[model samples]
Target: MDAAWLNPEEWTCSEGVQEVLLESRKSSTRLTYLAKWTRFSRWASERGISPLRSSIEAVLDYLLHLRNQGLAYSSIRVHLAAISAFHLLIQGQMVFSHDMMVRFLKGLERLFPQDLLKDFLYKREKGELLIQKSKRLKNNLLKQMQLSVSKDGFVHFGDTVMLLSPENNKSPTENYPAACGNLTLAVNPDDITVHTSESLQVPCGLSAVKSVNPVGRNAFRILSVEGNSMGEPIRFGQNFGLGATGGFTDQMLYLASDHKSFMRFAKKSYLQQVFLTDELSYLTCWQATFLDPQLRLEYEGFPVPANTKVLITHCHTNRGLAVPRNYWIRSYFGKEYEVICHTYLDSHKAEEDKNYWIIVTANPSDDGITMFDRPKPPSEETREREKNELYAGT
Candidate 1:
């Protein structure tokens, strides 16, 4: 970026100090770029393709080739940046600035992630493309992690973790796994329990090795978890099961207050099954136990999570971290209910409030749409009344 390094092609012998500095920078920059450019050239030539004048697909194929070689994210960035610089050297600008190219680079960061939280767009079973929304919180950049890039470059997005971990960002260099807000942790009964503060969403991994079906446009498999023998439809069931009972329920709407014992575990320092959070926007309106605020006299319907869940297992060990946050609230129609537990494994996080909704009843109306009441926290006066009542009763 320096003026002296601008003309990286300048190869010269100099006697003066400034001249020597300029030459050294030029040589170093040129050498570094030349090596990367040559690699691309050789790669293209081997495949009988052009490097600089290549099409977007060609360039993407080259990137995929590098990715298949197990390149680190930083290293891959350097390669692409080098290509951009190469084009700038000849064309006085960049070749990788197209919208498709930009998306390709952006997709690389998520498709090939440095941590647990990932984002990308994938085509669903019905041919609808869904974009997964993921946030890179501050916790992502502060962990001590050692990444193992396998030669196959195949990352497992199906891991379900129960991290009852504290929000400790003090150690930036500890050998730990990168934390994402949502993850698909393996719920094995034999694995040792790990307690961390991060509960990442790991949606279903659709592969030929495992069961896969084209259902929702979301990025996960719909596992129908039930309460009182309720279940949701899966791709396999929808396509194969003519009258299967496990595949007919909805994945978005949750039954509130079905599990009343959630509050008992909420207060424990270690037990964190039902988390009390004020961040309602993390999920769709229908996914919340209370009424959704987005509903209006002007608007037509409510929103829902891309994925949803209705039940979870309460355990004392590491499995507790995998439990979804449960909430009990009153609907606008004056009905009291609790939203079902939406664990990280449930694809509900991917469910959008647009068009789709969670129908919590077995026999919903012709239209499963309904209005909800706005939610409000308990007032100070109410808290005082409860406190006084508790003292008086004691």
Candidate 2:
């Protein structure tokens, strides 16, 4: 018969063939069959034959062509299975009988015996070795990201600035006076000198003594209070910064936390005017009617909220964290203060007279210890009062 006489549309129009095609459409198996049918049709057209009238000899020849193209044996098997299913639908029985299908499958198995055996063995293995190795590498990276603070007011681990309060561990007498005095600030791994102080000690922690030479310049500094006065877990000696700076930015990039928390400074009047509420965290943008009020800023996103308090801890780069590059603020709160910014850190040191800040240190290497946000625990009296109210049903 002239194979061209057997039209594909005619074959599809057959009662049982249409039903079989419809059933296949609802499954992945049907999709595979349709793809194989397309390839078979193309091959038939090249031979001037209708695919429907093509003999088993033609199918075998197509399979040989696939083998010569170096396709995986498993892929070839899927192609054969798809073609055989179509044959069964048209013939009303297994077109390649069960015995013939088995022989074809056996031939594929022989073609790539080692690969097939390896695939089988890999599936049987209790755990995926590659996955386990990947997990281990991730864990190691997390460990490397953890920030470490030392007792001597040195902050280490990632790019970080240590903001120390004299009150952290010292008596009132040990605290530095608010008045101007000689102070030391340090820079690290290179230990490059910036300033010299006659009164302050040299090689102090990770910082060196720097003399504030306010020559032909109006240098103004301000002290600020930080942390939740509502009695959160902020402890003494915790390192904090005023704004994002270079070194600290590098540290943050390495830490790679899912979220970041920082206190920002706002104009004093604005802070007083804005309504304070728990849900304020959800605000994307708001205008403050008040002026010059210091606002406490906690940034979960960036540009760190206009005029908010900023901690000088190293945050990993937003780029490394998959955040936008411009997220870090160069200047904020109408202040020209520099905030430490980086992907990693070594050691951090805090200057007690500078500002009070806190650090919430987390070990990224630790498993099953993700940071969580919850309401502060109620006081004992508050808890008892709540219990009493519940019992009274009022």
Candidate 3:
């Protein structure tokens, strides 16, 4: 062994190796080779050996170490190349014999399926080619589309057309052909409808709501309720303002467009179905009822089969303060009842009063029905403010 080659000072860092490589190859290729060299240098340094003068026996030892560490066969081959290159540069002789290289490559072929490796290589090469082609095409297209402005402040493209202003030059409906064989169009937000109700038909000016274009349309209405049951934050008379159109399906909940009624299929509550009974003929009209999967008629208190048609409704989770007796009477008598007029007087507020009116129709008759109502009020400060500002100003 030559003592000069074993000198630590003579050996270089992987970065230095890359600097030398840059003189002969492209920067990208040099960087890749440098990465491999760095790994080899680290491995040799850990073993107290000079990487540039490492012997064939040392190479075998490094390969065994890599295998013991669970490195893949392909990675080991890459390491072998780096080690061989380092030794050749320093010792002026080849470190790996042709037979050894062949054996190493054969081992890699066995460890990784040939089909998998071939596909990986094919995709890697194809990606590079595609990127290069895309760059060239983009440049050509940009050059062809470039326009020049004249003394009249009009943009001209080879005398085809004159652009008046920046806004006029850009067409709102221009369609660019895509590789997927579809024309991608530009849309104007002002030309489409974003929000509307089920009762009020979406205007024709907003008919392009379904179009898939930049600014084309997003015309679907959606309402998201945060409670487990339909009754909490949304009360009987509350209006759930529709913000968009066309997104609702059947059974989807909504406030009445007229803002007077809360409509939902009766029997939609699981609690009502679980408690239906025979003796209780008149179910609560405020609570909805429905037939369960077992073909059993169900209501708030009695899930029974008494050969009776029951009128079911929905209840808010807060539990109404007054189970209006009229609600039960209409359910048993099968007659419509007017919710003449009701008032919500918050005890917390002395001067403010809010009232609501409703008309309900119920069917089926039995007995033992209960109704309760509690009066709640807003703050006195709020009432005073409303009187001074809103009502007084009006």
Candidate 4:
């Protein structure tokens, strides 16, 4: 075989074809293609192989070599384009169209989930995609309506409502809903009752708490082991549980003590995920502490008011829950951010705004339930009236 195939300058192309090829692409692109083609030619020559008659196995090896050299998925595609163009010019063959080559590229994409282009692509499994869409639809329906409340005139224990951020409420013109955090927390085991693992902790799904809307996964039913507080006001510093409002699994927010589960940035603090365990241990409890951004202690031990900013710190770690704005993860719903529990200083140092959350009640009118209203049982007069009415009907 003539070594002419190893060099673009020695290609046995006619003058007319060469002129037409020059007109087909910009000078910059032609130069880039030629440069990339030269690299491949040199690799083939080192092995004493013909570049024009390269097999699928040979091309795969070359692509893998590029990947091993730290070339991104997009960069690999550029090399393929150059090789494909030059190979067609000389051999009139489509090396890139081979089934194996196509599959190899797809495999590369999956192997590197952090690829820049993967952000805009749908990388979730088919079943997960459907589940995400269904969850989104359910959230939309919830947003169209109000939350479920109790009769205590405040968001009582066990009331289900969406946790909205007060950050957007400060500026009417800003679109903060797009940056709202939604829990991607899930149960550790699908069936927690039958599971026998003691170290089983609830783990956050591939997606964190980041969400575009403040409903569905954002809705949670306030719970507590204190059954006496069921109809009472949800007070501050009280250990409570948060069960995700909509889902087949009983996913409740829990702070995993396992060192392996801590956030990468804040290693001392735990990453906030969901637990599916039926046990009401301290791990699943969190406290709505009264540390206001303004440095006020006026609301300590008071009922958690609606639309009022409050700090939610994990009871186990005493670290405040936060969502790092810069760190993001791709999900079936879209790009989402990670939610973590950070050490005291990391959570509240000058950036405490990220730690502030509002408990939005589902009540339509503000007069119906005010946080100032102290929860009380029915009065004796009202009880007597009810008794008389029952006797009269008998």
Top TM-score model: 4
Q: Write the per-residue lDDT of candidate 4 for residues 131-220, one digit (tens) a residue.
A: 455444344423432356544445577676655433323343353433543333322222231132222233433224533233444556
lDDT of 3 by residue, 214-288 (tens): 110121111223222321222222222212211222312121211123442222211111111112112211322
In terms of lDDT, model 2 sits at 0.34
Of the candidates numbered 1 and 3, which has the greater lDDT value?
1
Cα error, residue 352 of model 2, in Å, equals: 75
Q: Residue 313 CA error for candidate 2 (Å)? A: 59
Ranking by lDDT: 4, 2, 1, 3
TM-score of 2: 0.26
Q: What is the TM-score of each candidate against the true structure?
A: 0.24, 0.26, 0.25, 0.43
User: Runs in model 4 with CA error above 4 Å?
Assistant: 1-146, 150-153, 168-215, 249-278, 293-298, 343-351, 365-394
> Model 3, which residues run further than 4 Å from truth?
1-22, 25-35, 45-48, 64-81, 89-99, 114-394
Worst 10 residues of 3 by lDDT: 159-168
lDDT of 4 at 128: 32
RMSD of each: 24.1, 24.4, 29.8, 18.2
Q: Give the TM-score of candidate 1.
A: 0.24
lDDT of 2 at 179: 21
By TM-score, the better pick of 2 and 3 is 2
Candidate 1 wrongly placed segments (more than 4 Å): 1-26, 88-93, 115-394
Off by over 4 Å in 2: 1-21, 24-28, 88-92, 96-98, 118-394
Provide the lowest-lDDT 10-residue window in model 1: 236-245
